[model samples]
Target chain A: MRKSMRITMILLMFLLFLLFLLFLSGCGDKIDLEEAAVPLAAGIDLDENNKLRFYVSNPVFGDKSNDVQQYNIPVTSLRESRSLQDAYTSGALEGRNYQVYVVGRKLLQHEDWFKILDVIFRDARNTVLDRMVAFDGPVEEMFAVKPKEQPPLPAILRGMVDSKSKRGTTVLTTLQDMHRQIYEEGLTPVLSEVDYDSKQKSFRLLGTALLTHKGKYAASLGYQESVLLNLLKKKATKGVNLSFAIPGEPNADVFELDRASFGIRKIKTKIVSSYSDNRFRFRVQMKVSAALTEQLFKYDIQKHADILEAQLTQQMQDQLEKLIRKFQRNRIDPVGFGIYARAYQYQHFKPLEEEWGEVFSHAEVDFDVHVKIISMGTIR
Target chain B: MNQLEKHSLSFLQFVFIIAGIQISIAVLSTPREVSLIAGTDGWITIIIGWLITSIPSFVVFKIMQRSSEGTILDLLRKKLGRWIAILFTLIMAVYLGAMAYIGLLRTLLIIRVWLLQNTSPFVVLLLLFIPTYIVAREGPKLLGRYAEVIFYFLFWLPLVYLLPMKQGRWLNLIPIAKEGWGPILSAVPGVLFAYTGFSVAFFLYPHLTNKQYAGVGILLANTITMATNLLIAIVCFMYFSPNEMVEINQPVITVLKTIQFKFVERIEVIFISLYIGIYSLVWIPCLYYMAYCLNWVRNGSGERKYLIGLLILIGIGTYIFIPTFNQSDWLEHHLTNFGIVVEYILPIAIWICLVINERMRQEGQPG
Candidate 1:
């Protein structure tokens, strides 16, 4: 009896292992890559009839050529848009591989426009690392261009925004970051802006679009100004290069031009704010290790170093003060000064948390800048 | 009848067993529940919860130390009457059996949602039970070894949470005590659920190799659990905004969604799938104790096969009956309250009874 029981146990174990293997190989619905339309990019815009329009782009490989298949549909829900796209395709449309989400300016005008994309963040399988870009015009115009000599539009747009942000010319905003910024009370959302430049006949990067706390489009900052904003926000540490002009003497042989161009390196920004008497006092301090990357006029570096440093500091102070005034004028705090105030001054800032933007608009700010020329571009 | 010396566990193994059971399913949503109550101060409530749960944990150890029988059930039979002992055994069996079943169901549900969305619940539970039965049938010594192995393998899981710190905002943690102590204090009960598995100490103490230092082992286990919960809470607090933190259903796993790699994306999917190992840790001990309680009543020798078959039947029944997620959530909510009564209140009540019985027996004797 014992021998027979041992034999029976071994057979049972073998049969269970076989069942395990069969189940491990999945018996129900499966994700088939070939039958799935791996979307490259998705765009949201408002139709001419004031309805929500969603567009998805997927790449198709052919026998003799490669092309991107585009699907445009007006829908009330984002998940339902996939089914609409499926009517024109041979495969199931999926959002798992989308590299970018393009939002038109018209769509962002609504206060709660961000609520529509809740499915992306809520779905367990959906990926949210895609780049989020805001187009100045209708998103369809940007999608209509099929660069004859380049890769897909999504790859091009992602590459363009990524490289520009790395060079401190613009900001890179992902869907995850945008989600946090939209909800964070101390910070506001800033999306990388893109537009179709009709003059150049191609899509172009247009710095950053600043949004209010409710995610409404407030204003747009230019490329140069975006770099400054990034520096102030500490997003750009080493790659910032600022171009400024120094007034030149017309009579001097070497200083014939009206102004001379120079760049600032190693830019460091500090914001010191204190709340008292229902108002915030901000002391903006900046220190830069500068260099003369280009000079249209000749001046001795060692002889005029002190004068240039002083003049550069003055110019930076003027420009920084102007930028602060513009932020105050628009009543936007893109630099996240409210974040610092709440962290450093908890008791004083807690009561004013909800009205922080309005309080920032009425606050008094002063600029104190220090610039030191460390090198003259590999020259004396 | 088993020998007492043959089933003893070392001190570290005791600690690992308690810590493993405490951490399994609670860590998945502990941060979110705490944040919903206390906001950014949720970590503080976790510390408070750990200290409060330690009282019952010590009471369990003290009661076990006073017993000379092989197990808690045997002691109950020796001190109390046979009827009372049988009553307590049934209560414990039902409690532990429910715990094991709910834990397995939740694990399978998460796997279905996060990792294997296409797989059937029955198939998933079948594969999950294989490892659990294999490890648990060998008893506490091998269970200890399994817990230790899973711990060492998954110790790096917390380190993965630190990757989200790149997007963290230190400002979100500020304005400390902004919501005041009321919210933080109220959140302690929610945090206590994370520390609920400590009641396993009642069953585990009689098997300890060094009973003298069981106190230190219990405290060490609680400390490990508290530190894990605190780490995840603080990371989630800093990574997500206050409003956003409350919105997240599972802050620990959702925070992992931000982690990306060039070679492999969606690391959380892989993490949740591998988390099946740790999930089995909780069910193994619970199922073993449940069967052990039944054997106490029946005086049986082959509890292993019966326990494994019972667990499979329960898993299949729950899968068929509780076919939807909302029903599972509703059942889990009720079970969590039941878990509090068994894990929190039962130990202290038993300790009180043991004290009263000892005093009454001393009075009855000629002193």
Candidate 2:
């Protein structure tokens, strides 16, 4: 009886193990992605008739080679759909299943753009966030301008974003970040806009696209302006090029200012209020170590570093003032002045939200740039 | 008609089970709320709460050391009379059983929403309870030994979950003590709940090889739990704004899902599977405690059959009652609040009464 009981127990254990293995195998079969194609990048646009146009990419094996190739398929709808499901069904009829549908540039003008985003997020199949992008034109145009000899559109975009050599403005914003920005107070959503040339079959980043809270197309910041915005937000690299002309020089000399290496001794922002006219004045004091890129003057630049410091200080001050005025004109609060007001002086920001455009326009901003050339790139 | 064999658990096993109980389904949802109350200083609150809860744990451990051969139920009966002791034990047993059932249910709901959407909750619960009931039926020693082996896997999961910290904003932790002491004080009770399972050591004292080391073991376990909670809370705080955290249904799991791995697409699926080990760790002790309480109440004879029958009834009732996520949430909140009172306040009260009784016994004696 004891021997039989042991044998029965052994058989029972074996049966349980087999059942466990079968359960695992069943789970494995349910999770098959073989039929489903994973999309790398998605683009959306509105056609001439204001119909929803969806662009999707899927990689396929190249002929006579082990290398993979990407193909862009465009699908267009006859009428503007209120829901993504409608748009998706229309696209599906065109023989393309969009795993991710980007909100086209024209949709930025529509009031229900956030509703589109909600539809995308609600779907489980469209799980990838990094591949989603918002375009300035028809989404199909972006797909038409692939790199001449690149692995794929996704690889190209990923390389551009991850490139270490590209100083400043290299960080890529995912769809998740954009979603957060939309909900966050005092922050505007920024997306990379890809403009394509059909004749040349080439695509280039048309700088960052900015959106207003009501899904209005505010404006696109040019490449240089976007770089400046990134720097102000501290999202850009520390080692960015700063160009300024000498007092009598014919040519403008460019200096690579390594902000990381530059010893910033102090940064003080004083908010001074004048009893007269009820105006707030922002005075910024910045102290930094100077580094020279080029020596235009024959005189010992180090000896008369004080003169160089004065010139550089004035240039930096003027540049910063121009950028600040530009930001105010554009009604962009990338410097997070609004965030500061809300977090610190909540009462002040309560009314400022309604009158932000006018308030920001008249706000006094003073810059005090003090530069001391602590070192000259470890060379005399 | 067999009595439960006296079985002892190793220190490591005790730590694993206690840690599992401490890190519950609430940790997935409550970190953000706690952070909102305490701001960047929320980690400080976890530490403070751990210290406060440790005091009771220390007192219970001391009492258990004195009565080395008896469980907390025994000490309660000896010190505070049988009726009150039985009443308190009943309350604790119910609370623990509810908590275990609710935890299993909540986890099933998460799995359904995130992973196995097609699978029924009953099937999921059955799958969970089979392993849990088998191990729990083996008595506390085997449960503890199994916990010791599984604890290694649990410890390694957090390291993988926290890899996305590189992108976390350190600035989000700024403006420390911004809300001041008022909110911090209010959030202490919730933080105290995170350290609730340290009291489990009291019940498991008889099963400990060295009852004296139980205090040290509990303190060490509490410290580790406190640190883990603090880290997760801080990370959640840094990742999401106060408004966003509150809006999220399951903040911890959602945060884990946000972390995209190059090789592994969704880490939350892994988290859900590994969490079963934690659930079993918590449920076994709770079931054992329930059995222990029932045995004591029935005068310790023919209790094994009764214990198994009661477990099945409780499990089935809980499964039926908590049919949806909303209902489970309501049950969990009320039970956890009740748990704080029974687990912390009542234990301290029993300890005080026991101390007084010992003093009276000594004073009443002639020198």
Candidate 3:
């Protein structure tokens, strides 16, 4: 009896193993690589008739005709457009591999435009690590401009924005970061801006698109102002080169220009928050250590370093003050002064937290900058 | 029926058995749950929660110390009455079964959502029961070994959660106590529920090779649990902004979604799949205790029949009437409350009765 029971137990184990192999190897939801349509980039734009247009650029595999297969359709929902897009594409649309989400300026003009991208953050399978970019023109025209010598538009655009962002010429805004910016009262959203020029047949990397707290397009910052913004935000710790025109340049040629460039080795920014009178007051202190990279006009540096440093400090202060005034004019706090205020002064800032942008517009801010030339470039 | 069941668990096994059970489904969502009540000060609630649980934990140890050779049922039958012992056994048997049942269903729901979406949950439960039958049939001895193996095996998993904090904002933790102590204290009771499984020490103390170190063992288990909870909570707070902490659901796992590498991506999926080992640590032992309670009522042998019957019943019952995710959440809500009554309230109540009974016996003997 014992031998028979032992034999039966082994047979039962085999049966269970067979059952596992049968049911556990799922055929119901498995999608092979060829069957999945992985979108490299997705664009959201509002058409002239106020209809939402969704665009996805999917990489085509094993097809010699073209490397990328583009699809666009007018739809009310992003997920719903996948079914609509199936009319032209062979594979199932998957958002798992999305590398970028491009939002047009036209859609960004609306106050509630950010609510549409909720699906990306809500879904468990979808990724939110992709860059969030803003287009200055209609997104449809961008799809039309395909350079013959370059890779697909999505790859080119991702590479360009990534490199530029590294060089501190543009902002790199991920979907996760954008989500925080939209909901966080302390700061506003800033997307890396791009504009396609039809005559030049090229895409231009415009610095950064500034949005109000409600995600509406407030203003645009050029490359230089974006660098200044980067300095204040302390994002560019390295590779920050500033070109300033010095007064001591001698006219050597008909097209002689007085210019000096320096690479920043280190920068320290401090914001002091104090509330007095009718408006909140802020004292901005910055110390910049730089290495002189190029100089067109000759001057003795060792003896009069203080005067040169003072002059550079004055120029940087005026530029920073102008940027702060511009932010105040637009009622935007891209420098995250409100973040510091909430962190350092929570009790006083609680009542005004809802409309901090308006409160900040009337606030007083003074900039104090000091520049020190730490080193000069070595000549071979 | 069982001769060699004595001296089954060493000191290390005893400590790990309690710690493994404490890190159940609660660890995954504790950050979001506590932040909902305490805001950015959620981590402070964990310290207070540990202190509160430490009281009930001591009471449980005292009750177990009164009868080190047997379960609380044996002590009740000897000191009180058969009626009281039967009642306690029935209540605990049902409570333990329900906890194990709900824990299994919750694990299945998590697996279906995160790991296997298309596979049948029935199949998943059946497959889960195979290993459960293997470990639970022999009772606490095997359960102790399972705990030790799992605790050491997955020791590095929690360390993986620490990597993402390199980008976390330490300033989010600054200007602490923004909302005052009221909300932080309110979140304490909720965190106390996560520390509930230490109550399993009632059954485990008898199997211990050294009853003298039982107190030290329980304290070590609680410390291990506290350290794990504090680590995950602090990481979630430091990595996510205060606003983002409240917005994201299951920030523990969802935070890992952003972690990327050149070789492998979507590390959370792999993390969840491997987390199945830790999830099994909760239910397998509880199922054994449920069967043990039934054997205690019968006053019979530690036969394998009881465990086999309970396992088959659960495997088939769940297949016939599948539990949905929402139902599992509802079950979890009631289970935590029921666990507090059993793990927290019952020990203190029983200890009072034992004290009164012992005092009456002394008076009858001397006077």
Q: Per-residue lDDT of A25-79 in model 1, one digit per residue for the tens? A: 6755564878977779999999778799998888886672448888778999887
Which pairs of residues collide in model 2? none
Q: Alpha carbon lDDT of residue A82, candidate 2? A: 23
The candidate, 2 or 3, that scores higher on DockQ is 3
Top model number, TM-score: 3
- What global local distance difference test value does model 1 have? 0.80
Candidate 3 residue pairs that clash:
none
Q: TM-score (0 to 1) of chain B, per candidate? A: 0.95, 0.92, 0.96
TM per prediction: 0.92, 0.80, 0.93
- TM-score for the A-chain in each candidate structure: 0.90, 0.71, 0.92
Candidate 3 C-alpha lDDT tens digits along A46-81: 999989998888877775534777767899987777
Question: Per-residue CA lDDT of candidate 2, range B239-326, in tens?
Answer: 6655456656666766676677567765667787777666666666776677767777878764456556755785587557646777
Candidate 1 lDDT by residue in tens digits, B1-367:
2555677788888998889878885878788888887889888899888889888888878888876547787777887778888898888888878777767877877887777777677767766766777777778888888888889899888778778986787767776776789999998877787777777777777888788788788888899989888888889998998878877777788888888898887888888876787788778988988888888788888678668678667766866765466776677667778877887888888888888998999998976
**What's every prediction's RMSD, in angstroms?**
3.1, 5.8, 2.7
List the lowest-lDDT window of 10 residues for candidate 2 chain B: B1-10
List of clashing residue pairs for candidate 1: none
Q: Rank the candidates by lDDT, best first.
A: 3, 1, 2
